[model samples]
Target: MSKVFLSAKLPAATTKILTDHGLTVSVYAGEGLISHAELLKSVVDVDYLITPLSTQVDAAVIDAAPKLKLIANFGAGFNNIDAAYAKTKGIQVTNTPAVSTNSVAEVTVGLMLALSHRIVEGDAQMRTSGFPGWAPLYFLGSEIAGKTLGIVGFGNIGREVARKARALAVNVQYWQPHRLTDPEERSLGVQYVEFADLVQTSDFISINAPQKPDNHHQFSAAVFKEMKATAFLINVGRGPIVDEAALLTALQQGVIGGAALDVYEHEPQVTAGLEKLNNVILTPHIGNATVEARAAMGTIVANNVVLLEQGHNAKFIVNA
Candidate 1:
């Protein structure tokens, strides 16, 4: 039987898929991330390793598992694993994509609404100090219906956001490295623009891009300055894509109207002073936290393992 090591806890249905296929699986049942030393020791004799996206499976971790054939990530993004190094080591890297598309897209829109409408602020006020009572200008907030929403990285999640935002009468525009064909844009009811135009013209901006070397700190102070004074920023994508220090500065100085982040520049460690700001809403990376998305990710990850064990090319393989 092929031996597998799961680095974190997952849904029982996910493990069942492996055991039912006659694979031996050992899972780390701890409350937090598995330590690097523990991970290095666990993979010594394992053939397949499954891990959460937050866990770093770097070159050292890849080297620790000489017999490892696959690294199945339990999230849509695969940047946690070093695919280039894994390919050299003849290890297949796979991620569960599209499984979290709807969930993440929904959360993206939710963040937009929460930030624009002062939903979180109002809720906090009600809980902490009691309601101040209603007045025309008591809790002024923006509406989504007439504002232009710019989405960065027009992939599955981005496209979904466009569809949903359009239903709310939002003028949705998008920018990615490659421009979509006219027909594709028309079908999605979105307009394709350059990155500069998207940042400058949008009333609200959403980041759904992946973490690539080129994308690290892509949203810098200069970029923030280009945005409208009343514009809002929402990031449901990778954290490192936006420089938190710069973002904090922007938020503090009113460089932009407001901002919301589900992911941070550093995992588990948020930049200081962000929580103290009323203009920003910070959520623990919960873009894919929905029950449906988590379950679906588990299923997709389990299916990939089964496929690889059967000597077939697994689905969503990032490394050849």
Candidate 2:
């Protein structure tokens, strides 16, 4: 029988899918995340390993699992797995990419609105100091309508962001390594622009790109300096894409009017002073935390594992 190991416990229904296919499934039932030592010990006899996006399945882990045939990742992003090494070892890697796109896109737009309108700040004031009543120019905030929104890394989430932002009368422009065709651009109601122009001209900026070695810290001090002083930045991408220290400085000095981030350069350990800043809105990386998204991701994970066991090519293979 093909034995499968889960680094963390998933929905029972998901595990049942594997069992129905005649595969043995093992789940890590610990409260917190599984440690590196625990992971190394668990995968010894498993044919398939399912892990969270944050768990690191490095070359060392790969070498330890001689029977491992597949790494079925539970998240859209698969950066945690050493896919290239897995490929060399004749192992397949798969990610659930499509499941979380809408959930993340919705959070991206929600962050934009919260940041521009100071929603969090107002709520805090109403709870603590109490509202001083409405008056002209009292607790002023900007409207997203008629504003230029520049999107960095135009992929699934970025395109979705453009579609939603356009509904609010916001002009959307995007920049990526490959520019979309003219028809594609017009149909989406978005324009393709050079990266430099996008940063300088946009009233709001959203970073929706994946994390890559070449693109790490892409938004540094220099890029922040080029942005409009009244502009806002929204990052739902990987944490390391933006330099948190540099971002902290920018927020402190008003380099770019304000910012909202769902992910940080050092996740769970945000740079000092960011939490104290009222100009920035910070979230605990819940971009894909919706109940619907998680359920879909679980289904994809089970489906991929079942496919591989059935001698069929799995869907959403990252390391083909």
The per-prediction CA RMSD against the true structure, in angstroms, equals 1.0, 1.2
Per-residue accuracy of model 2 over 1-320 as CA lDDT, tens digit each: 99999999887778989999999888998878898888999999899999998789999899999999999999888899999999999999999997788999999999889988999999989999999888998998989999999999889999999999999999999999999999999999999999999999999999999999988999999999999999999999888989889988998999988989888886667889999999889898899998888889999989989998888999999988
The most accurate candidate by TM-score is 1
Question: What tens digits encode model 1's per-residue C-alpha lDDT throughout 94-154?
Answer: 9998889998899999988998899999899988998867888888998999899999999
Could you tell me the TM-score of candidate 2? Answer: 0.97
After superposition, the stretches of candidate 2 with alpha carbons farther than 4 Å from their true spots are none
The C-alpha lDDT values of all candidates are 0.92, 0.91
Candidate 1 segments exceeding 4 Å error: none
lDDT over C-alpha atoms for residue 7 of model 2: 96
